[model samples]
Target: MMVRFRPTILRQYLLQGQLPTTGCLRSQARLPCIAARNRGAYLLSYAPVRAIHSESTPTASNGPADPAFVPLRKLLKDEAKKQKLSGKKKKKNANNQVVEGWELTVGIEIHAQLNTAKKLFSGATTSFNDHPNTHVAYFDLAIPGSQPVFQKETLIPALRAALALNCDIQQVSTFDRKHYFHWDQPSGYQITQYYEPFARNGVITLQARDGIAVEDGEGISVGIKQIQMEQDTAKTLAQLDNVHWVDFNRVGVPLIEIITLPEIHHPATAAALVKKVQVLLRAVDACVSGMEAGGLRADVNVSVRRSDDPSAPLGQRTEIKNLSSFKAVEDAIIAERDRQIAVLESGGTIASETRGWSIGSTETRRLRGKEGEVDYRYMPDPDLAPIVIGEDLVQHLRETMGELPDAEVDGLIEDFKLTPKDARSLVGLNSGMGVEYFWNVVDALKHRLGSSSLADNLPCYQLAANWILHEFGKLWFDEHEDDAARDFGFTEDGQCARVPVDHLADILFFLYRSQITSRIAKEILWAVFRGRVPAEYASVRDVIDTEDLWFRELSDAEYAALADEAVKGQESVVRVFMEKQEKYPQGKLMFLVGRMMRLGPEERIDPRSAERVMRERIEERYIPRLRGE
Candidate 1:
């Protein structure tokens, strides 16, 4: 049999110094206690009958008797003091010397907006820059009789992101209500996966860069606590005079929040980790990952502790919130870490609080006291049912998971024998489109060159990479200098709109064969990009012929005659070379070659060829006479 006891009756009995003789009297189960006046409800988990032997409790000798009550105020105060002292002790050594410096510990929470046509829970279009509240629906406004309908489009990208991060995707996950009171949150609760996240136990390994602890070719791994799907809040516009405005168009947009463990030791490591996530998300088409437009942002939690004390508990962390840029994230972590160390070293305690990153000043400003888990009052949402992933769904997502950034980078390094830096630059092209364009050009060149292997054609690969990254990249950027949203070689619809990949390959092919100099190649590229070249001239050779830009190597007889004329024209230089042959042999010969190239040709001549012919003529004809041989 089961019995229930009202909390009021239990509280009265405890206050009256009476022990109930009934079921669960000796049980260790927690019982709720409701108190009168200023005291609120509390749970009494340890109710020992031995402490209350008699119905009437004995009065204290030095104070009024209240034997049933134990005030938690003094106990909490003592615990706080003990914890503070323990933290301080860890900063000192056996000689009681304070440690020279503190270690910085950082963790980041990234919120990436999922790419979809509609809002996550409503049918409103997800287009940006619409009139304020124009795209909002009844569900987005959280009206009296409205409910959210989940969007299936959000799951694919979310799953792809989980796989990219090496996360363990859960077969089953549930949503919860994260309660908070804010004007921006019209619903007063955000629908998020709090109890069981979609994925967990993931890792993101970052290659060492500037300000990070690890060296080049070395990496540091950070643990991913979880990745959860959550709804975005409305954008608050506080710059208006006398009234604040809210934009609900962004409300109900889907986001996947990736929470990392506190393993970062430097600001740069955190930034690098964020950048890696951005690249992965973009590669998988999970998000646009635009920080400036608020598609991606980070909340960085920073703390400082003694580097010597690995076992010591971490210092009270201050979270720098809503850092929209990588530079802001890194700078904010650095500033917060320094502030925390300065506080501890000056005999002050670090407060557990939430801070705002001041982008302009590069500092962290106090926002609010940190909130505990209980403060949110999380509960499973009754409206939405739990989602279950079957084997078929997981298999489909895995099968379609395209090449991620790291894998692509490694492939470029191995197959093309490109350096890690160059390979990384290629994979990082236009958030991976550059890689697509690069390989497309390579394949086209292979067909043209009658080669079946990229590895077999190292020169072609090198030339393609160099021209695409340096020359083509410059032209692409220059064409879209005013449009920040323009992607390389792609239109807004994601079509290949810039110079065709095949055309670029033809240009590189001509360059590889030395039929045209780099200057002519660049000019041909620009002409094609600007549509100045006619369609009939499809290949680089045709373009060179049509535009009359082909360069010719000088014939030996022509070069001999030109060199003789150049020596006669620059007699002073020839005399100097003859007088000081030991000091200026090669230099004097090259001077004659340069003068001959300038004076001999209406058509451009190859400089190297001219130099060779000039050297042969001078050594056989001029040098013999100069040395009296």
Candidate 2:
């Protein structure tokens, strides 16, 4: 069976040309088309006339496919036949190819945990702890008939995020019920917005590989479809024994889901977009600090088709879920792209499905059925009132917007004169540390350098960026590390291990301007990690400083003991210095210095005193005698 499509309404004879009887229609060629309704429109009627010679049907090939492919040619033919008989007008792309080659579409949706005191619809305290079920509220447990109450704290921050993204803040928005059944979700439905989200149409900028900063531009617009408040689901813990437990402490936590259109084209762009948004959110104190702790998460929707076909309706879209890091997101997209292109090459249909991100191999595996809007069962929440945002409220929040990551990166580059690489590292590290911590580090350095515009000082910014990225801040991935024990620590009471920003600021300044080497700075941070006073110089600084100042502390006796040992074996040097006192020899003085330096602690003389005494001896004896000649 073969399915064929016509190119234009006026070109009905084009179908005749596509038939096998004509020499123009190659046996190996495949065409895609839509059926027209009017008399002059295209037709989809199949006629099977036995051919004189047996030949294989042609498949779409933008490139070579995988060897293990089974062409699903029968499926496509059957679907095309069915659509024709049903009298349904088919809508196909004007072009036959699917993937876009030249132009790339890119967008991002940042799922940020709100900085709310309580859950969005419940009064449960939203805090991090290692304990299980400590933060679970009755509403979160979805105990049969628990009613939801609304909080303004969650909404305020969502608007703040929308404003930061430069989104169109709607004056009114409502909540909906997004239904999905999972172990984590105690409530069958998630409270979110569908009809009217808080905001729409926003833009974000990211630094590309070429050092060129690109905003989600015209073809790459990151259209923010909606920014809706939602409650987080519980965390699930599965043991090696096959027992699964639910930690509801994370349930009902206030969160905002920022959904974006399918605009991303390249993996690198996707990564940069996610990172930029994450940085901005953290800088504004709009989201939680950690990605693994479910403070931030994302779902990437990807489709691939041939470059020639701009309108060849995109290939089946795949949703890659629960990608916590920017790297993971990029990997998932690459893996999916490979999978989709391979399916097409091998004569197989790309399945619309959801896949899980495997960080270890950076591959995606099929999880379940396809993702669609119908799955969420979105509807308005009856308990909560529609949000009424006033101009005054927007203006009040606007005043709070300080320097975001984009503006700061520009400032760092122009004012501080930092290289792109250095600025990115500093911002990356700073994002991991909360907003207050980052500012404190910058401010403390200014105080130390005694320059009001220290960030603008080239030397000061370079030193500060180095300390923040490599010296003081060490990223912790314990939240991602799997445990084999009884307790699940992703609860409200879980004590998240964070680098204390203020103390970290103190450490950066202490290392800067000091004579401490990079190696010594690492030691100082290690001591701080062990709960020692970060400012305590004796523990860390004393080790290296004591070694450096050893020669300065030497006494007369100590110097004599070392000098006596140094000259014993090298009597030739002494004799030469005396005879050639014709100018006390240069190598002889160097020999004495090297000999004194090599002496062990017990035998070594103080460096300064040894030099002083040696100089005095040379002046009193060698110089006078040499001048006499």
Candidate 3:
């Protein structure tokens, strides 16, 4: 069915004019009448504004006003009405489900916890993993008689994060109060941006397997609606059997809320968008960006409607929250879409509400209905002054933003001449490289081997990459063995062993460049790691370390006795060399040289050099026919 929105509402839908989101702005903007007719509908008329003699102080909990709206609200309400009407007359689909190939419109709101040394308003530390409540200050805890003092350090990271996402920075922006009630929130309402966000009109470029893709621009532009700095609520932990504990340590931590337009369609795209944002956040060093740690959280809004009907508006959307994992987020969206479709097919009305995903059941369970917007009762924070972004601040932040993950990955591929797949694997290696140290280790190995040209040799690079990730990684991170017992104990995973880069380079050079067998080099490496002398030594730590070399510990008297005995016993094998110089060559006499080298377990002889010396001596003394000729 065709539906038309009133001029004011349509203006907001097209984003033609900015709407007042604050309670103060909402009261001044007059409401308009919404008219709907079947099959084809147009705006019949809008209610004229009734001018009041004098204005009254706006209260926080002002009930719904008559025909009330600014632009965005009017558009949202008109669209909601159209969706509600379409649901009543919509035909039932098969399997009591929304038909396959149903068009789904997706949008994302990403909240990143800003990385900082201190809380937004308090001097308490913002670092993670501290003892619970250790980082809380009076303001952070929302203690009685406490006032907030805004921190510039908090805002700097948000700006950097927005820039990393390829967002346009707004020169002018303001904050508002977002209201709700919870024990975790000691503050009645959160100070956020309802007027002007710090970042807007940003586009993110992400590379999927197929080609380069932008989150916005395809259909919805997934355009960045806004990014604002706010404070985080306290963490709540619920244990077994209905016991709950609140950790106020995280309260008032600085955070960034990034809202996207309705553009994303596929589940993979949603996951990709999340991952891309994660990279940018980590690159900026703002917010830990670790999913397990809840440094970042995403709320997904999904709506499924018929592609066949252009006139019919979008279906009612369910807001799915608490989706911490990428897989969970996608699954929740799909499940919610299916649930909405099922409700429509069963001839039931779908209510607009917030829902939580139950991963165990693979369903979106409703948490709340179209609830009234509680008055956060926003007013200018008297305790804190407004932040002004100066040219130097912007310039400094721009420099700190650094290259984002996608750009860095591209550099790795271009600079190292890595294949696309290899580059991707490396970028995603070890849950994605979060710091420079990981990349440095790989580069150090590459440089040491002088294998710069061998990067295109993927098999060789893979071999090297794996060893660093596994062997070196194991030394620090692997808990199976404690290195305190071992000679070298590098406390952290990144610092595996202090084995110099040049030393490793020499070992690899011997194996690959000098053509030493890998087996022999490995033996040498083992001795080096154990702090043993070169294998030419006979004894180590008062033990015969190996049978190969045996003369180091023994005195001069023992070497003399063994050499005399070897000279007497090997004359028989030496006699044959004189009789048949034509039949027995160096190859045949090498066996006898091997025998003499093993004669003294106390002798430390270079095996190859000794064999050459023995052959030359035998040829000179015993080969009579060849010598005379």
Candidate 4:
């Protein structure tokens, strides 16, 4: 049976075209109309028809005697049975086609572990890799008669992040108890700021990307709903045969939950938002922002609605929980969006539930039924008093909030004339430490060169950035191995710690002055990475001398004589250059230059200088012979 809809109404709904609310659908005397309220608007009107069978007459119940009283459930069930009997496959929209009606909406919630030495409200060490439950304290395990206390250090990063995100800092905020039942939650309740959070009403602008390619001049701004400081839950490990173990080490650890408004429409936008948050948290030194290490976690809420009707109510949303990585967040959103679209297309209702992202299969699976706000009976925490952040503290934090990543990137671009890509690369290194190191080396180079500004010397700045991003970054990765290790702690080798900015500056200075070759500069950097540089050698030049890596260029006269000898030896190449002057003059000339560079003195000669000298010889003698002049 075919279901026919009014072309004008259906077209308006399908194309997202606006229609008058009063009479979007025509009222026919024979057909009954059912009005559906959508997003607080009277938007959709449906007319149901009876399915006629070839062998059987339609009954009054099946046809609905009352024109306005159609049973949607029975109609859908009958349609499904009819399709099954006909052995027809479920109709599916083309993969590339925008499901015609649905629009995806996403909101992100991030739990960033605060970088404090001790657990919140306790003196337990917040260190990782300790024995299970080793980091737990009396307050963490909620021992009898134990009371909660506040950690002042946790507020610093949270406030800094708020300021970085341009959130309004709340002077007064209260803590509340969120009650839930879970083995991982030892206290049976969590202390969180539900009634009043620390910060709110902020926005973060993210660069939008089309698939993997970033779109230029296109950005999306998502609102920060709230930021609240809270304690973390313990780690739960389930073994074979339904055996489970709870490690309280993570329990009571400080965390700040950053919740975003449901303005994100694309998965890439959601991922970009999370990555920007990670950078901001790292810039403020509030959170480690390592997804794999449980330093940061994201919960994504996704829903879909009819794109054609702006006033259509959103479809039932599913919450994808504990998405540990940015990629997982993006993938989960995309997968869930497709799943919802398929369900709706197949005439199935979307279920509200909590889902888990299957990293192995890249799909979201049901974790539990969805819970509402009322489920978590929230009340003010009696153990801890309300936090009153004074103007003095806020002003001090604002003052001490070091250079954020955006500002630093702009500075690099404006000062060094670097591309946005290069500037972001430099400022985005080691959570801004890489840029700091680059500038430190630049300062040293400026002082040694007796120059007032490194910016005026563009070559110096470019060379410094290249070395830092390529060579120094490689050395750092080799030592630290992973992002968490590099960001948090160094290895036992102590190589990274030993190489000072001055060492790199001295090496760059030598290269700038042509005192050493690029190859020699790299060798010196390798030596620094390997801890081979002795304390006696105060600079890279000294180390170069000791290692016999210094390559002094030959004098002009000596180079000219060597060029002459190279031309005489490469007699065939010179003849080719003369014969093919009109066809491959430049190429044949470069061949002679290569011969000159290879046959010259042991001293390293610049390739550009060799090319120039070769061109001069060909023009002065070889070209004249070839042209018969």
Candidate 5:
């Protein structure tokens, strides 16, 4: 049925959060008529929404303007508030399951240093590791006579990042000075984009691999509120000697702050979203380094709400500032949620504030009360002109920005026929460099090791995925995580522990050709990882040849002789193994083969091949002769 809603009814329904979000609520009329897929078949809009729900206050004359929405408002108003406050919530660590109690809603605000050599509004260079105040200019120090000049080159990578996230670029966006008082920001105000953010309404969907711990983890698309350009403050060092020092080197450095909507329901989801953003930005060369380097950081807003009532208002939220790592992000949200739950259980109301996560305390430390928009006293900057992005520039950037992470993920699944989990795992490595390295190795194998035909490339893809993700990735992230990037690297400079891609390819090729046993390959792997092999032996083949780590299948007579030779020291063990082989086959047989394996000076036999040979000898020859069959 077509619903005819008067302008007053439409306005009241929207203000009371009873209507679905359609699009931007603008000053002008939306359209003469629009198709309503969920609400109704056809809906009419004759007037514009002057402001959003929170922007305009409800007056006395507006007492239940829509009779249909009044019952829902009254029904959920009290119970949802209580559910947010006084119930015990059940969670299994970031799962999206519907708990009987309160639930969490989190949003992320990420500020990343742009990958530019120079400052945003000056000619001074931007350096992270240089001496204090060496890269500063007069304007960076807030000189009286200095003026800001915008750099056009900073927009190249920034636009590439925005477009990579599928954001719609604004044709004209202006700048505003946000007033604040801080020791690091010597200028009384920092320039920002308040009223107009250039890139809006983008999305980053948490991939399948990210949600292996969560229920219904696929396609959780976190909406992007906006992406705005801004300047960074100088570094402030709070010394242990009770003195404060400021370095102006980072002053006026280019920064892009990406604001996300509160669509995240769990701490793990928020971490996944931030990681997705990092990989996306790094893939575009927008932000070169990661959160560990302080090149990108996230501020999360956390709130607890009742899961039973969908129409209930969100609970009081607190902002957790400067969460540097993804694990820190997850831990902060869990900490804040537990804190709010405790406050409500004690008959105390939660307050809005800004907090910081302390790694030592494993909790969120209270920073200050949250600031409102009016506290900033925002105003337009008179010196800078409005940024007008041309259509031609947007087109050029779109053409050269390369394939985005989302598309690349889909391609990996469809083209390579890999599992969705494997595809996302490949993309998440080293901020999207894992997929690049995978392709490089796959291409090398296709040409050098395997046949070039498409039918024969399955082995190449499977081999690359297994070794990179299982072997190299495990060592890269787990055991050698501290120095793996530099020591066992996937970086541009191949100055690692001699386990670069080419050397790894050589090792995999040797194993693929069946010239070396998996154990010997592992020996080579650990040798490369631990730098045990001398640098003089360049390739893995050289090390393998020098160490005599080759595989050879022995004949039946040789296997029988080896088994008889191994029986000398293990006669009692062989009798026990014959008695226990039928019941427990796991450890009994391998014990005999292990003795035979150590009989040689070098590793010349594959353990798997030797186990097969010994098992057959025990079953067909040794068992029958012992039993007189």
Candidate 6:
């Protein structure tokens, strides 16, 4: 009767007034750390840390967990059972991502810092350039008396991201505390959406231009598994003198983790998917901070399999963490894939693990063994309530969100007869302003001609796009770089100070309509960009006239004199022209034409007219003389 309630080992330690140290916690080796602040995104750098990997269940060493945490235990148990039953993984043609018989499968988790004005739960302004630790509030420090006050407005950007990806938004989504011990985390746990995320089941279609060929014209689409809003951790600097530097300014900054399905096969497609997501987020004004600015970080999941047997299972996957650039994403995946293939070929087991990219080595190195879900005790957040928004808010966001970059690219191709490269170039300009400017220039050209169509099948829109992106873009980039001459520079305020759209249209109009030669037209355009023009002229014709740049024909006397001088100056060319003896001897006659056009201002005369005069002179003088007449 007295032994009916014998205690278990962990319970005996607890009942004997002794708190057993958590197995995972007992291995902790956290060193004292410091903070750093960066611009653009809240986080600047992540410090290296040894991650804990434990197979056993956690025993109580601290206070009781919120009851809501226990609800997810059953789900974890079920997932474990399912994984045991489903033992293997599988992928695609994968180009060079693998050797001929091997296939590659990759999934990515992108953490993009939101552009909201405030932190997710605190009133601290979400400015990245602030002093380290100055932006943190009491709750951010996990102070006992101060609790997290939810900021409902932060969800607006998260909503935009969901709608942009065409994800199904949950009417209600709850947050959970992911418990882990890291030097950067002031709190023992991180508040995130684990059990029930806000959005799910969307797709992004990739195009051939994105480096992935459209298979049978069906197009490659990457599935959006879920998009969950969560809090970002503090910026951590790599250990210096055995001490870590931490920037609490980034602590609790709002971040949305967008998880993609394991559908990517090629490294190119994986990088493209990340870039497309970046474009989508920026298009919706959700995440304006670019990847270069530390606004986004990606974790790439890579797995490989042998295709010799169709039913053969995929190899274990390795997770490559914190990739900031597209090149890094692709390179890291390639390295990891090669590593796994080597291991499999050598009869070595591929262990599931977490790895890091070494930029200097251009390879991947193991960080730690992958941690299971139970390793991170998911407890319901006791302070923050579930995020709930109405249908009306969703409708409003949908109405306000701009057209996606891909849609704009297709529109440019179909409506304006633009090439894929040209369309993407325009869409990438000035945060979509380039596309708008392109349309404006096209309209201005049409208006000047008083007709929508150009003579001789001129691609009016295509010409405009080329000049804008190629010619102007060249000068624009130069203005920001080693521009010594400062020709066609930006405005004093460090802006592009672009020449008016109509001004560019004028140049395009003059060039296409044959009112001015192509070389002359470019000169006039530069003058306008350089602000050398006395005033903004009404049209290209006006600019040409005001600048004395109009193409002028040679007078009859001038043409005869110039032709005589050209054929006499290039005696060899005339001999070649006469020897050929064909009616025009077109190829040989080019030397004479080029010589005549080089006479001072005669360069402004159209090459066609010069060619005609030179040919006539050659026919009247050189050809007859060679025949011994």
Q: Provide TM-scores for the models.
A: 0.74, 0.61, 0.61, 0.74, 0.75, 0.73
**What lDDT does model 6 reach?**
0.73
What's the residue-level lDDT of 358 in candidate 6?
A: 53
**Candidate 4 residue lDDT tens string, 1-629:** 13344544443442344454775434532222212233323232333222111123334433322134445456556766877887975432213223456788888899999888877788788966654554567788677888887877778878888898889999899999999976667689999998899999999876532222142236767899999998999876543333344566788888889999998876777887887888888878878547767799999999998798989777789999998777678778878898998888889998989999855233589989998889998999988888899989989988988778878877887888887777877776766677777777777777888888755677887898988777766766674355543442222222135466777788888888887877778878777655576655656767877767776787667667777887785667777766663466777777777777778743478767777877777768776876788
lDDT of 4: 0.72
Per-model CA lDDT versus the true structure: 0.74, 0.61, 0.60, 0.72, 0.73, 0.73
Q: Write the per-residue lDDT of candidate 5 for residues 1-629, one digit (tens) a residue.
A: 12233455455655454443563334323212111333223333333322212233455555322123444346545545655576744344555333458888888999999999999899999988864555777788787999999998988888988998889999998889999887668677899898887788898767656652365456578889899999999886542223344566788999999999998877777887888888889888899588979999999999987667988998899999998888778878888888887888788998889999855233688999998888898999999999999989999999988877778888888777878778878877766767777877776677675477545667656777778778875556564446634345555322233466666677778787778877777778767776655555767888977877776667667766787777675656656656773486657688888877887423556666678777877777666766778
C-alpha RMSD of candidate 4:
21.3
Show pairs that collide, candidate 3: 31-67, 115-287, 216-221, 217-221, 550-602, 551-602
Off by over 4 Å in 2: 1-109, 209-221, 430-457, 473-629
Single out the weakest 10-residue window by summed lDDT for candidate 4.
46-55
Return whichever of 2 and 4 wins on lDDT: 4
Clashing pairs in 6: 34-245, 34-246, 35-246, 35-247
Per-residue lDDT of model 1, residues 1-629, tens digit only: 12334544344445454555665454643312111122222222333222222234344532234435434456546655776776743221112112256777788899999988888788888856654555777888777899989887778889989988999999999999999976667688999999899899999887743224442137878899999999999876532123344566788989999999998876667887888888888888889557867799999998889878889998888888898887677767777877787788889999889999754343589999998789999999999988887768878888888777877788887788888878888777676777787877888889988889776778888888887678766776684445542334553232355577777888888777778877788888877766664565666667888778766766778878888888885656655656773465777778777788678763556777788877777668776767788
Off by over 4 Å in 5: 1-99, 410-425, 454-457, 465-503, 519-550, 561-596, 599-602, 621-629
lDDT for 93 in candidate 3 is 20
Clashing pairs in 1: none
Query: Candidate 1 at 609: error in angstroms?
Result: 5.3
Pitting candidate 4 against candidate 5, the one with the higher lDDT is 5
* TM-score attained by model 5: 0.75
Please write out the lDDT profile of model 6 over residues 1-629, one tens digit for every residue: 00111133323333244433545322332222243333212333221121111123334642222234333347546655665677832233244454688888899999999989889989987868654555667777676798888788889999998999999989999999999877567788889998899999988888887656333134588899999988989886543233345766788999999999998878878888888888788778788576778998999999999877767776688899999887778878888888888888999988888999854233599999998789898989987778887999999999988678988999878877778878877786655666676767776777887876644235766788888778886666664545543334333222344477667877887777777778887778777766665356655576767768766667766777877877765777777766664475676778677777786355456677777777777778777887777
Poorly placed runs, candidate 1 (over 4 Å): 1-100, 209-217, 238-243, 479-495, 534-541, 555-629
